[model samples]
Target: MTSFAPDSIVLNRKLPLWYQVSQSLRASILGRSPQDPLRLPTEEQLAGHYGVSVLTMRQALKELEDEGLITRHRRRGTFIEPGVQRGAPVRLLGSVDAIVAQQSGMVAKLLEHGSSPVSGELAEYFADVDEVATYHRLRADERTGEPTNHARNYVRPELAERIGLDDLARWPMTKVLRDLVGVRIGRITDTVEARLADPETARLLQVPLLSPILHYTGVTYDEDGQVLDVAVIHYRGDRFSFTVTLDAD
Candidate 1:
């Protein structure tokens, strides 16, 4: 079995010193104090412990803050944000199917279903395709009654054409891919970013603008690494945190 190593910071001339320091601290927090939400070290304490200037420590903290890994209060001090948990560290593969399967009682609603040409940035993924293929768009919610995430997925026409959009209101798209499409997922590539919810997302998620949201861009492939589907999911920052394990080897 091929096991991937955890991502880490390389302390070299190629990167800035503050960034390297921040990465080390972030890794420590993710690895050590995940369960204790309020266990973040004070900025001054961190600077003294790491043998860095207070400014450098502040810079490190700023980087973590930008990544949504930590939060700062005026006088209350810095703390880990609530509900953000580290997830298992695996290859960037099969994440969608795995996540949906792990979380029960989640529901998917098919918002739009159709076929269109792959254009712009998406065209690069399909290669040599002129006409638009079948497309499946869905909104997946992670809550029983109140939705915790709003996800949109796009798949190749041939793979998605036969699946009924109406079926999503009842079952997750992953199930449809398995039962209707008959494609066994092999790998997935995921890109994560933190952004404020848009107006539509804010309204649908019942949150105000500037509310934190985690955007996930994912692509799933078959056993032979054939592209199966691409998905974009938005999760409520206040409700969830992605987790991954890292080992120092």
Candidate 2:
């Protein structure tokens, strides 16, 4: 019932001005109700609402038109194309259970899986180790083909050599390491931060420029405090949320 009204979209500088207009308008169409009137605001109204030039606004509308999400009539005004699939509900989780519970929900596409150098901060952080087997996976919402998160995990080269990308795609690192490879786990630490979606990241996540996102860095350690593995996740804030409990101190 909540539509992305033009008044609600604030402009930002990270992306082209016209593209921002288009993104906001696209969100508007996706959130609109089926029974709701399909008429889009007039070009003048839109330009005024979004505080952009009519040329910029028109360019934005043209972008939407090219996408086949809407059409314009001689006198009837712009309208949402019938039968457009409503965007899926934003995924609301941050764990393996959500990733594996459904067969076609969240699956990782292995982009690169091989040994990578450990240098700079990571090298210092894992001073006891040098190189690591790295797997860069892009997780997507299969139903919508929208990327939900990107994960890059590192494991000891010895363990990495024994792990297969196919198995990693189907299971979490913890599961692969603990059950398949029989690695002993001790403790895991996760640090979370709020960040803006950079150009590259925004493209992968299909979100507008400067959209808020969550960056999670986690390290798994053995009993001896040697780093067993590390994982970094970039989650689209619009699609995922982290749930945590608090203890009164």
Candidate 3:
């Protein structure tokens, strides 16, 4: 019996009510602990919780059912699919330390690792080097084993040699770079935007084709102000939210 606060359900009047409600419910489903039972509240109860009509709640549940997230039976009620929790919508916090803390419990699986020639868009970042090490990894919630992030990393050749597969699978790249590789980080630049997932992305993330995703591009620079790594990470749009707070002077 997972519950959410009324304030937690922020509905944007500009968006379709059903869509917003579905997303909010999806977040709750994914955020729930695996130890919890699969059963969810009835449509009427859920509708009451969301302050939407039964019809609207039914529509929202249908969306989740169609996505293979949940199954419904007139007599059995609704049960979420096993091993399907996508974790909560991660709030992208400021500062490397905060970001690292946010990623603490995820389990990483190394997908691909090798050295590639520096060319195309990455050429500018590694202009001085002829080749760079590349890795592709899938990160999932340790508790539920539901995939949440797919990342491709391009590391500077010099630093990449010291990185081990075991480290990559166990820790975030930022941690590997700082704690293991002993690199001094001078700055990190990140840009986030919405994009539709391609076939590969959808397969890795267990989401539908062309589903909206949060695309993140990050560049890490060393103490000398040279690019140390370039990372591209993709997150399910429904499973993440970026947060930033500004202080008024």
lDDT of 3 by residue, 1-249 (tens): 454331135454545677667766664555445566788888888888878899999998897798677899998898887654445444433345434444554788999899999979998898899999999999998767888989999998888779989877766788689768899887788888899999999999999999999899989998899999999999988788776544342
lDDT of 1 by residue, 20-135 (tens): 67656654454332234454667777777766788988998897787676789988888765544433122222234334432323444545556667768676666656544443
The clash tally of candidate 1 reads 10
Q: Which sections of candidate 2 miss by over 4 Å?
A: 1-105
For model 2, the run of ten residues with the poorest summed lDDT: 95-104
The residue-by-residue lDDT of candidate 2 on 80-197, one tens digit each, is 7875432232222332222222112355688888787896858855676768888988877544677888888888888877787787666567657765788766667778889999
Worst-scoring 10-residue span by lDDT in model 1:
86-95
Model 3, residue 44: what's the lDDT?
A: 88
Report lDDT (CA) for all predictions.
0.60, 0.69, 0.76
The TM-score of predicted model 3 comes to 0.64
Name every residue pair that clashes in candidate 1. 86-243, 86-244, 87-243, 87-244, 93-188, 94-187, 94-188, 116-132, 117-132, 134-157
For all the candidates, what are their Cα RMSDs to the real structure? Answer: 12.8, 16.2, 11.3
Sort order, lDDT high to low:
3, 2, 1
Off by over 4 Å in 1: 1-97, 131-144, 247-249
